[model samples]
Target: MTDEPRLSAQDMIERLGPVLSRRTRIRAVTALLAGVAGAVFVGTLWWSEPGPLPGRTHLAFALFTMFCLTWAGYGGWLVTRRVALFATDRVIAAWIGLAASLATTAVIIVVAVQRGTSVGLALVVGGLFVAVALVLAVRAHARRAALLRRMHELSGREER
Candidate 1:
């Protein structure tokens, strides 16, 4: 009998045997979702409400809803992809949440710069959005890293 462990989908890819197994399909889906979320967020700025004061105090939140949806779509993609790979949904949700928050912030900045009546005030408004986005992104990244580590441990155990 052979002493080698049974070859898995990942192993098949290494041998160049039609690399796109179910697992690869999942990862690719996650990556594609992330890319799509980012693109939608950057592209959606044209619809934000212009403001005289350039602050959230007056801006409507319909655009914000879109941002959240984009994020959710990405997360769903990630989870589905991960499920296909190793049956784990770790870090996928976090990635989507982070991308959504940042995209919303970007939209706010665009609105402030292009639609705000005052240039100086618009910069201040945009700056605040950037700061918030930075904090959210950092938090999301940290959380995702932790979850990914846990997933790795679980996956290792499964292999054994």
Candidate 2:
């Protein structure tokens, strides 16, 4: 056996606990709050409409509301399970979030253009969403790189 001492299971757990818990809590709360707020806003609009709406509009609202609820459910699961999300998992999740943001932005822009109303506002909001998503993606990638570098350093030390 190598002379280097290893961390005990408890020590490893203690080391990881703070890092994982903070990330998990932040992600869970963000997801839950965004999802619930989106759902409520969309639902309110759909319910309080002044006149009859097209079937497609109804369908769109339902789908968007469902999408928000899905995120909320995911957040709830994360909170309840407190699963350990690794750096790679975070990278993947960030990419998924970026894609979702892009698609949603595209849809919003299309709808605004078709309606000929608030097109500029839609574009502005969409840009913000895409920007946030891009930032998250970049941060995730940087984090993963850092973790990989740390892993390599530890392995190199162990080999010596």
Model 1 gets an lDDT of 0.54
lDDT values, one for every candidate: 0.54, 0.74
Residue range 66-90, candidate 1, lDDT tens digits: 5545555655565454223332333
CA deviation > 4 Å runs, candidate 2: 1-19, 33-52, 80-84, 88-93, 117-121
Q: What is the C-alpha RMSD of each candidate to the true structure, in Å?
A: 10.1, 4.3
Worst 10 residues of 1 by lDDT: 81-90
Best TM-score goes to which candidate?
2
lDDT leader:
2
Q: How much is the lDDT of residue 32 in candidate 2?
A: 79
Question: Candidate 2: deviation at residue 10, Å?
Answer: 11
